[model samples]
Target: MLQSLEIELTSNKKQQPAADQLGFGNHFTDHMFIMDYSTDNGWHKPRIQPYQPIVLDPAAKVFHYGQTIFEGLKAYKTDDGRVLLFRPHKNIQRMNRSNERLSVPELNVDVVIEALKQLISVDKDWIPTAPSTSLYIRPFIIATQPQLGVAPSTHYQFIIIMSPVGAYYTEGVNPVKIFVESEYVRSVKGGVGEAKTAGNYAAGLKAQEIAKEKGYSQVLWLDGVHRKYIEEVGSMNVFFKLKGVVHTPALNGSILDGVTRNSIIQLLKHWNIEVIERPITIEELYKASQNGELEEAFGTGTAAVISPIGELNWQDDVLIINDGKTGELSKKLYDTLTGIQMGKLEDPLGWMVEATPVNV
Candidate 1:
């Protein structure tokens, strides 16, 4: 861990984009936070500096072997000018777990949180206030040793960048069409699918592209082995409401344990709703839809919060959920989750943590 932190503000401030025009991850803030890791010194030299392009050798391990991991969360600007981070500690714990999976050194959670707060404070003005808008925080670590020996790097850089953004999907809280991908497998039981790594997403792009060509917003990936059991919906954890019970795939080392997924499960349990986590086969879901038991479906993630799956195209069989519209439970979950994050509702679970020392 670093002894102290340094700050280097930008000389020229960039003009802010219009709130209505702020798309997801398109506009960045003025500064970023960076820290270095070395075998000899461990993680040190923490600093907040100007947002600029990263400089690394072409032979860096991150380029050759893909040794990197990232975590995403949002900072919401409340009506009272307070900046809040939803379940940031959970994000940190997940990030560290990802670091372990990717063979990267673990991050000091307390120090990282402190740096996050200090960095967000420096660029607090960039926090968007539009509806469904927030400052997206991306914390990433890259192997920087510039070696190509197919081994972990001896040096690394951990950085945090902020993006002022709107909805991740164009549909926002509405329903989306999903194509069940069978041609490609996302990950296996003992793979890096659970980690929030770049490679996992890059591998899913081909399937996503195919789904896009098929008039779908995303692809619902099944397990690698069976190609029958459901795994996830694009980058989000999927949930299906069947016979008045909520069912989601268990995190059996393949599906990511999403922070939003956990929150949704907690919310459902708090409302005395039955939620089952187990291996759910796709055929079973299709059968449920055929029997009029499949009531609704939605996905949970940090970026898209709640994406209602309106249509699922499996083997050319179209399953329209809730008459191809957003379900009441989906809207309620989105509203309740967003409300708690924005301080518009009572936070019974204390999930939202103030990013700054006081209201900004």
Candidate 2:
């Protein structure tokens, strides 16, 4: 374990109702953890200050170059009232990988974890007790050096903030519709698609809005070059069940390697399920859906543990999955995953990290 961080706690005295709602990232806790980085000073000036707006120069490198990266994870309040985090180290490691891609300096994994622990320890009351609800932690890095040049900023700020959030899907754990994009592409071989950067999502919003207008919940992105191999769904990694086996797109530069997705693959493989990490094409998925071989499909992310895909709208054609209901495998996977998260089942994978207890 790393050394615990020194924090200054500030309570959100008046706005208690907003925190109680936990409707995703709408409300924030009173305090946040922040650290600064520079080429000379490295990472310094760690503090837990009141949740407030950050002042950045108009000519900051991040403002122009868009050199920013972020990671999302959750803190869960168990039935025993103990708060815990699910695989935070995975997020830290992935954030470092994202930093390397975005030309940002990397923080030590232990330091990142300690910073998160400090933030959660100060805002433990923000962790909701409702079923399937948790405190979502957003940790991000940004270039702060005020330079108009198109180079990486020498100064940076890393911060972690907490938001009490409800379940992502309001329609319960039911199935969702996906729009297969044969036209718009998300990432190419040399692109920054694998990194959790802000620009990637900013570029995806237009397509996502179009998807919503077309009666689809999310867009299933394909490779930019070939436009054949499936990459990932919007903001989530995708999994396909065919021939009683699990198949997902390989981590081939364009896919975001989700912590939940990796965990599900490991869980399936542990149960002797043949889980293949390979290139699955949209045509292949369509064929499987038509021939009754497609058993299940779901998208996995920190926000949405697992969202079952009930239908796929590809242009004029429609493909239904498992009779347009949550399949057996989808239910089992979701139950097992959430069971471990809510502390109702054994955490054999040792993914849960209990937060330091504090009375609100």
Candidate 3:
């Protein structure tokens, strides 16, 4: 068991927004969890305090060197008023992997999880109760040592904040059009692509912006070297259903090990579906589409859960998938995953971790 965390309630509780208007990442909870680290003291002063701006020196290492990592998860409020966190341990484990890649201090998963439970208990009311809505949790670590000489910082800060959010994409669960990016690459082999760091996302902004301008929802990135192998979507893992089989890009040191991606693979296997993780080139996918073998396409992530891809725009060829409608398998996976997350389905995998009850 971990030590108890200090709680400091806020005097001003922000008014919660209506369920329909609770767009993605617009509103934050009243309290946030924080812990500090140093080379000498390690992690200390775990607490839940009022949500406020953090004060850091302008010359902090994070500002110059970009030594930071983050993880995204959600807290669902069940119909019976119980808060459920899905596969939170997996997210923390990935966070530690990101820390290792970024040269930051590793965190104790158990202690951080305990802190998250305490923080959620204090601000449980912030969790949305509407369908397809939940409290998005963001945990991150940043190097804080003011003197930035390129080496790893001696001081770091770990923080967790909650935001009540709806769908990540404006299209929600509807099928969206994606542009296959050819000019810019998101990551490469032996790079920081697999790590959940800010720089990786920052590097994709240019490609994403170009895709958006061309009337697409997201960019489907290809391999950096060959630029023909399908990698992933802008913020999610990409999957292709061809000839009654599911294929996703292999985690070849470039693709992120997404929690939702892993869960979907597990669920598919449980249903006796053939799921293959290997290098899938865009040419092969286009050939399958031409042969009417490409049945469905979707992207998986915490923010959107499962987003169906209706159209893929690669060069001058446009392949419309499943008649621009959601696929049967996509709908089934979305319903099953969301049902399990919302406490409506039997959790055979035991992925949901219940938060401590809140008195208020």
TM-score of each: 0.98, 0.96, 0.98
lDDT of 3 by residue, 1-360 (tens): 246577889999999999999999999999999899999999998888999999999999999999999999999989988899999999999999999998999999999888898889999989998889999999999999999598999999999999999999989999999999999999999999999999999999998988999999999999999999999998899999999999999999999999999999999999999999999999999999999999999999999999999999999589999999999999999999999999999998889999946552
Q: What overall lDDT goes with each candidate model?
A: 0.93, 0.86, 0.94
Error of 3 at 4 (Å): 4.8
lDDT of 1 by residue, 141-222 (tens): 9999977898889999999999999999988888999999989999999999999999999999999999999899999999
Candidate 2 lDDT (Cα, 0 to 1): 0.86
Give lDDT tens digits, candidate 2, residues 151-205.
8889999999888888786655889888988777887888899899998899888
Query: 19 in model 2: Cα distance from truth in Å?
Result: 8.3
Ranking by TM-score: 3, 1, 2
